[model samples]
Target: MILRTSRLDLREMTEDDLPALRAILQDAETMTAYEGAFDEEMVQAWLHRMRDRYRDDGFGMWAVVLRESGEMIGQCGPTVQHILDEDVLEVGYLFNRAHWHRGYATEAAAAVRDHVFRALGADRLFAQVRDMNVASMNVAIRLGMTVRGRFVKNYRGVDMPHLAFAIDAPPTGREHGVSAAPPERRRER
Candidate 1:
């Protein structure tokens, strides 16, 4: 496992994970922020891009799996993002609808936040949340990020207004300025 939480595992996604990824990416309800569900071709391209990211940057969106059942519940991690003309490392999370409202997004993301800070040598981390995605915004907030700016993102032929949320890595790890606790263990990169 790349990183571990009390109830989850964050690791590289493989070709075998396509079906699990489809269950998350192809569901309309789960992909609302993405401008709707992805078709087969889009899903394939998404996987290929992530694989490329892993090879080139050593990290990308990872499979968030339930430790107890070994089931892939979501995708969450850092990716190279261009927000407001500057390339930044942004953490993102998307889960199956069945896993919604369960704190998994926050948990997985917190682990990733900690991992990126400790392992990736990142001084600041970001999350670009679509303006209307309150659920995702909340996850970013719980990760201790505050709105830094705003920008418009064109994706899937839609021009989306997004909020840029960010936080600097804290030396104490408890300075997140939010109530949610970081996972007990997220040691591996």
Candidate 2:
């Protein structure tokens, strides 16, 4: 699937994206939100798993590419996750350190949130944010999601505390921060 925003192009992940994916996922500083950086083998497995997810679930995290430079900056999309002991559609994202602070994560994530409802027909979408990930939590808020509660996840023998943020499908064409405009002025591009 291809999704376009003002600055990004989100598409399905492929094996060819391994090098770029590794650049982000394998960087210790970039992956500090998680327990640690991923190894080369782990990066391969991550790519393989996403490919399998495409075939099995028909949806998965997508590669976020820059439209002007044509460089992949990150990955973002929907995934079924067990949060608060229940299955929920979660919007997850990760970006290269070099691309941070440019609002790429927020833009990609907002588009994915819209897709999860407008295209996927889901009633609501959620994001799982590690407690320490203030940046990501801010992104979730910018997507118009509200902090629901807290939960703990066991990752690599570490007990990571996380907060759940969620937003339901817009009632009609109302989207947070999107003003009503004439067709020519709208940002439906």
Candidate 3:
């Protein structure tokens, strides 16, 4: 499935995307905000795992490509995280250093949120961002998610502070400054 925003085209992962994904994941600067850098083999395995996720779950990370140049910038979408207990669907994203600060992550993430709510009928969507990753936290906020809670997340065997943000259900008419009409029985003639 392809999802398009004003500045990006989000599509499923392909074997051809392995190289780009590897480069992004292996960059120390980029991966520093995450667990750590991944080896080439690990990167390939991650690609395969993501592909499998799409087949089994019907939704997974999407490759964010530049619409005009067709360049694969990074990935953003939903993933089931088994943390703090049971499973939870979390919105995650990663971008190459060059693409940072361009609002690509925010744009792509908003598209994914809409797809999850409008298409997948998800009741809520959440994100787990590391405490020091201020940039990622900003992206989550821009998506209209409020901080739900905090927990200790073990990254590379090191316990780190993590924040959870979530959006529950779609906005109502009142929230959007519009009045909802009553049912036919309650409507006036």
Candidate 4:
């Protein structure tokens, strides 16, 4: 599936994206928020896992591409992550360190948030942000999510604490009220 934002195109990832994925996933600076950088085999496994997710769940992290140049910058999209002992739809993302601080993450994330609510009809969406990942936390906040709580997960033998951020769908006409529809059309008859 291909989703578009003004500056990016989020599409299903394939083995073809391996090179770009490697640049980001294997960079220590880029993967610093997580356990550590991934190796070549780990990167391959990551792509395979995303492929499996698309087959089983119909949605998974997607390749984040530059629409104009057709470059694969990174990956972002929805994936079912186990959180608080239940399956939750999570808006997961990782970008090339070169692409950071350009509003790309927030832009791509807001698009995915809408896709989850409008296209997939999911009631709620989440972003599990590592506590120290302030950049990601800011992106989640920009997407209108609030920190629901905190939890910890063991990654590579380290207990990493994370914050769960979430947002719910707007009720009925509330979704398209005012701004989504012309004011004249929104006015009561």
Weakest 10 consecutive residues of candidate 4 by summed lDDT: 173-182
Q: Which residue pairs clash within candidate 2?
A: none
TM-score of 4: 0.91
- Report the C-alpha displacement of residue 124, candidate 3, in angstroms: 0.8
Candidate 1 residues lying further than 4 Å off, grouped into runs, are 172-189
- Tens-digit lDDT string for candidate 1 (1-189): 788998999999999999999998999988898889999999999999999999999999999999999999999989999987899999989998998898999999999999999899898999999999999999999999999999999997889999999989987545575333455544331
lDDT by residue for model 4 (20-72), tens: 99999999989987778999999998999999999998989999998889999
| TM-score for each of the candidates | 0.90, 0.89, 0.87, 0.91
Could you tell which candidate, 3 or 4, scores higher by lDDT? Answer: 4
Residue 61, candidate 1: C-alpha displacement in angstroms: 0.3
Best by lDDT: 1
Query: What is the per-residue lDDT of model 2 for residues 117-172, given as tens digits with 9 covering 90 to 100?
Result: 88899998999999999999999999999998899999878999999999988765
Give the best candidate by TM-score.
4
The CA lDDT of each predicted structure is 0.92, 0.91, 0.86, 0.90
**Between prediction 2 and prediction 4, which has the larger TM-score?**
4
Residue 163, candidate 1: Cα error in Å is 0.3
Ranking the candidates on lDDT from highest down gives 1, 2, 4, 3
User: Which of the two, 1 or 4, has more lDDT?
Assistant: 1
Tell me model 3's lDDT, rounded to 2 decimals. 0.86
| Error of model 4, residue 133, in angstroms | 0.4
List residue ranges in candidate 2 displaced over 4 A: 173-189
